[model samples]
Target: MKRGIFIVLEGPDRSGKSTQAALLKTWFEALGREVIVTREPGGTYLSEKIRKILLDPKSRIEPMTELFLYETSRIKHTLEKILPALKAGKVIISDRFTLSTTAYQGYGRGLPIKTVETLNRIATLGLKPHLTLVMDIPDKVFARRERAGEKLQGADRIEREPDSFRRRVNRAYKTLARRPGITRVNAGRPVAEIQREIRARVAKILKRQAWKRGNKKQ
Candidate 1:
């Protein structure tokens, strides 16, 4: 069986990556494709536990320590969920992946980009997403959305950071998207418009893949 495409949606918090991921999964499924929707730091049981530790506001972990924990979660998620699904020819729509680590830790936390990239490679085991759709929104829009949500009993350490940190994270995401195989989507638009843009992109990718397979068969 052909290996399935791995697509990731990445952005700062409240950028609607999760919503778009779900919508893309449904759209792909409607086209008779098997699609799996999953998220980083919480895709597997082990990862979910790590996610709790990482996200807890009370936790006072060091920067490197936090990065390692995220890598650990990603390694487990890749092995237990992503690899098997791809081998079975199912498209995997990941809400966040290695990019988050790079942005959050490498940029937001001021970690060296080279070190973060090395760790990310190990975490992913050389697997790269076939496509990455980055949702880009202004920092002001992100802040508005974040504040609109109910205040949690306690905010995570990352969430508690000043707006400057989040802005750096967003900049990192945009930089990453400039690399090959990543598509930057303007997420500042209306929800319906964003969804339509994503659908069109996915359709084009599917068509190209189908054409490639047909040629190989012929």
Candidate 2:
């Protein structure tokens, strides 16, 4: 069977990654493709348990412990969900991936980058997304999200972090965007506009992959 592409939408809190992922899923379904939409730290039953702990503001988790929990959840998610779907040739749209760990734990929580990368490798077993869309929003838009009560009533533990921590996380995402397989999208614009750009980028990848498969078959 032909392998499917893995695409990830990653960004800081209130950056609309989940919304964009949902839009992508719908768009891909309209094109008659087999697609699977999953989110990290919560893909499997056990992983969701870890997710609840991670997102509980009342819980005090040490930086390394938090990082370990994330990796553990990812291990279960990858083994139980991601790898199987990919093997079945389903286009996987992940809300976040290993990059989130590096950004949130390594950069946001001041953990060692090398150590985090090592753990991530172990958890993912070297699997990686074919493309990653990193959303970038302006401070004004973030403030608006807060003012609209999106941040006030719906924030997870990480979402409730201070401005300094969010700033660091944002910086890490920006830096990650410079790396290969990562595309930065300015999400401060209207949702439709951003979605259009995302579709365009993904279309190119699908086209290229189609071409490659044709050549192989020929």
Candidate 3:
């Protein structure tokens, strides 16, 4: 049986990633595909504990230390939750993945990108998302969302940072989207419209992959 596709949705905090991920999960399930919806930094029990430390507002963590903690959680999550589901031929949709680490810590926190890449490789065991959906939005919108109380209670550490810091993170996301195999979505659009666009894009990719698999079998 063909292994399942790994789809990751990445963006700055409050960019509607969770909503889009849920929409995609439902869309895939509606098509009769087995889908496993999970989130990084907290997918598994051990990872969830790590997540608390990583996101806690009061935690005084250095940039490098924060990076390793995030990677640690990812390693646990990948081994315990993501890999097994993918091996069983179930589509895995993640709210955030390695790209978040590259953007948030590498660019936002000014950590070395090379180090971040190495850690990500080890954490994910070289697994990569078949498609990465990057939700792009302006800093103004993100700040407004945070002020409006849409931010996650504990995960607002990044959001509460200075505006310039958030801009750097957003820029990193845009840059990553320009890389091969990453799709950029205008997250400033209405949530419904964004979901529709994501669903269409995902459907197209799945169909193409299915055709490729069929041809290989022939």
RMSD (Å) per prediction = 2.0, 2.1, 2.2
Counted clashes in each candidate structure: 0, 0, 0
What local lDDT does model 2 show for residue 169? 91
User: Which residue pairs in candidate 2 have backbone atoms (N, alpha carbon, C) closer than 3 angstroms, thus clashing?
Assistant: none
lDDT of 2 by residue, 9-100 (tens): 99877788878888999999898888988998889999999999999988899999999999999999999989998888888998899999
Provide the global lDDT of candidate 3 against the true structure. Answer: 0.87
What is the total number of backbone clashes in candidate 3?
0
Local distance difference test, per candidate?
A: 0.87, 0.89, 0.87
After TM-score superposition, what is the CA distance of residue 145 in candidate 2 from its true location, in Å? 1.7
The residue-by-residue lDDT of candidate 1 on 123-198, one tens digit each, is 9998998788899988788767752334756677778889788789988888887878889999999988999999
Per-residue CA lDDT of model 3 for 58-160, tens digit only, reads: 7889999999999999999999989998889889999899999999999999999999999999999999888899999877887677523254454556546
Model 2 regions lying over 4 Å from their true place: 146-154
Worst 10 residues of 3 by lDDT: 146-155
Any idea what lDDT model 2 has?
0.89
